[model samples]
Structure formats: C-alpha cells, structure tokens
Target: YANSTASGGRRAHVFNCHTDLYLEEAERHGWLIQIKSMIDLFDEGWTLRSIRKRLKKDPTCTIDSLGSPSDRDITPLRQGPPQDELPDFTLDEMHRQIVKFIVVDDQAINLIECPEFRRLIRLLRPELNDADICHRTKLRELILNAF
Candidate 1:
C-alpha cells in the first residue's frame, strides 16, 4: 500500500512539471509573435504615434511589448505659470537675459522682428507674445545701457 501511494505522488508531480513547461513555452511563443509584428510595423514606416493609436485600439497589445525606451510616450515638461502672474523682478530678469542673448550673439536687432523668429520664441515660451517681446528700440537701449 505504501509503495502504491508513493508511485501515485511521483506521477502527479511529473504531470504538473510538463504542464508548467508547456505554459511557459506558449507564453514565449506569443511574445515572439508580438515582437515580430512590431518589427514589421517599423519596416512599413509606421510612426510611433500611429503604433500607439493602434495599440490603444487593440486590447491585447501593449507599449511595453515594443521593448524600446524611444518608443515610450514622453511627457512634456510642465510650463511655468503665465508671465502676467509673475513678479515684476522676474520679468525684469527675463528681459535682461533676452538682451544679453542679442548682444552676446551679435544678432541683428531686426532678428526679433522676423515672423519665424517670433514664432519660434512663442513656441518655446508660451506665456510670451508679440506685446511681451521687447521691440528693436528697447533692445538697442538695453544693449547700450549694458556697455
């Protein structure tokens, strides 16, 4: 009776071991398939945004399955409070820095007047608009005062 019981326990253990191995193999196979699909999408020139949208629609797909840090969604830095809410001293310092850039770089006063330049500046500092930007005359005055 003891020998029969021991043999039955061994058989059960062997069955469980096989089942676990099979499950592990299946998981690995699925992961490989996901990786291949991602690679294929890249080959097709799919942008990260497009891929992310597709993943959102597919319940089974995950961003992690891409396995690249560059593929991950990046959060933009938090913008500071609007300049109107800032102290006068802070605004003065900001203007001084702008004047310094123009003087140090030997940039033309008219550079600030360029539509594209203003657009780029606004893009970087959303709080600033044309009115907040120093005019060429004001910039010139600041430059002269510094010397």
Candidate 2:
C-alpha cells in the first residue's frame, strides 16, 4: 500500500537483490543493438568495405570526435545585444501587429456575426438539440430556402 503523498513527487527505485542493479542497462543495450545493426549495414556497402579494408582496421569510435578541440581558438558569434538594447516584443508593444499583418474585407467580417447566417447554420445542424427526424427535415427545407 503505497501512499500517494508520502514520497512528495519523488520516484521509488526498487533494486532486484538477485539480478543486475544498473538501471541504464536496458537503454544501453537498445543503443548497442541499433549501432551494431548500422555498422553491419555499413560493412555490406562495397565502397565503405573498401575504405575499411584500406584503413586496415575496424572503424574507430566516433563518440569522442566532438570532445573539446585541442586548438584554443574560440570565435564568439555576436555577444548578444547589450541589456535593454533589443526592441520590446511584448503584447503591449505589438498593439499594431495584427493590423500590420492581417487585412480582412467587409463581406468576410459581416458573414461571421450575421444573424440570418447563424440561424441557418443552427437549423442545418438541428441534431445538436436532439430534434426528431421530421423536425430536422423541416429545418433543412428552411436552410435551403435561405440561400
């Protein structure tokens, strides 16, 4: 009987006494199989096989390739705009943003809030009110006449 509030959002990891305790074994084994399958496919390629043969050794691990470079060269790409030097992008500053990007004509806007159109739409989908077949068929006739 585990209490819901006892752990305070912490997860309980129960260790198996008889078997391996390393939690990351399943994740590592999956990655190992994926990498081995990729390598097997690479070995099947004639060009890659020839390259491997020319090297006279199995491919070295590429996992360490992205480690810190020995060269002390560091290039800073734009030391970001100083403090409040950047423009304000908050909603208050963007009051005119909608007007700048959107241009809706009168007819399209009128259709959205038109009473007649709303009534027609409600009649077309009368099943929303759980109306019977006869009532729904009568509403359909009125909806067709409105157009």
Identify the leading candidate in terms of lDDT. 1
Cα deviation at 91, candidate 1, in Å, is 2.8
Q: Write model 2 residue lDDT over 1-147, tens digit each, in one string.
A: 012323212212321221122113322222121223223433343222232233243344222222322232232111212345544554323222222111111022223244665565458555432222223244334323432
lDDT for model 2: 0.28
Model 1 scores a C-alpha lDDT of 0.49
Tens-digit lDDT string for candidate 1 (1-147): 011332334333532444333223323322121223334545555434455455556656454353433443442111212345643545567668677555434356667687998788778678876887777898778866864
Segments of candidate 1 deviating more than 4 angstroms: 1-89
Backbone clash total, candidate 2: 0
- Superposition TM-score, candidate 1 onto the true structure: 0.37
